[model samples]
Target: MNGLSGMREENERLEGEVSRLRTELSQAAAGDGGGEKVNELLGEREAIQAKVEAMLDALAEIDPEIAAAVAG
Candidate 1:
């Protein structure tokens, strides 16, 4: 696939992962003795978020309008 398509797919996958992590984090917070798990999930979520931001930045460099729409 082309760079744009590849990036879009990666972005979607990362977004899915972030959503899943959010769910797990919620469950961990609600369950007993899950402090460690919650922290780990948070860390992972942050990393994925950073990656998403970076990808968006790259997209912006390539096409500002497309990037804006995608970011929305």
Candidate 2:
């Protein structure tokens, strides 16, 4: 029971972190940074998007019902 609770807490934390990272990536992606800076941020945005996707997949596995509710 304790482990289950811990897992839930960790899942929530990861979800929050993923959300924050996604926002940062979205902002960076939209920004007009010049040249190398733009390319670097775009790369970071791609990495963050991949990570966010993975986290969402994991969350879906954990609570598909919730994911479905949110999606619909």
Candidate 3:
């Protein structure tokens, strides 16, 4: 695959991971004594989201149309 396709796949994977982490975080919040776990999940999700944003930025620089399509 080319850079655009590779980045799109990576972005999709990262987004899926973020969604999973959100679910886990929600479950942890609903339980007792899961403060630490919740924090960890939040941090992980944030990092992954940041990575995705950076990748989008880079992709936008390379090809705005492809980036827009991937982002949507």
- Model 1: lowest-lDDT 10 consecutive positions: 1-10
Deviating ranges (above 4 Å) for candidate 3: 64-72
Q: Of the candidates shown, which would achieve the greatest lDDT relative to the real structure? A: 1
Pull out the clashing pairs in model 2.
none
- Runs of candidate 2 exceeding 4 Å displacement: 1-33
The predicted structure with the larger TM-score, 1 or 3, is: 1
Please, what is the TM-score per model?
0.81, 0.51, 0.80
- Give the Å shift of residue 31 in candidate 1: 0.9
What stretches of model 1 exceed 4 Å from their correct place?
67-72
Model 3: how far residue 41 lies from native, Å: 0.8
Task: Give every collision pair in model 3.
Answer: none
- Compose the digit string of candidate 2's lDDT tens values, residues 1-72: 144465567657666766776676667667775455556656765775676566556666778785796477
For each candidate in turn, give its C-alpha RMSD to the true structure in angstroms.
2.3, 5.5, 2.8
Candidate 3's residue-wise lDDT over 1-72, tens digit each? 369788879978897998899899999999999899998998998899799878878888998796778678
**lDDT to native, each model:** 0.88, 0.64, 0.86
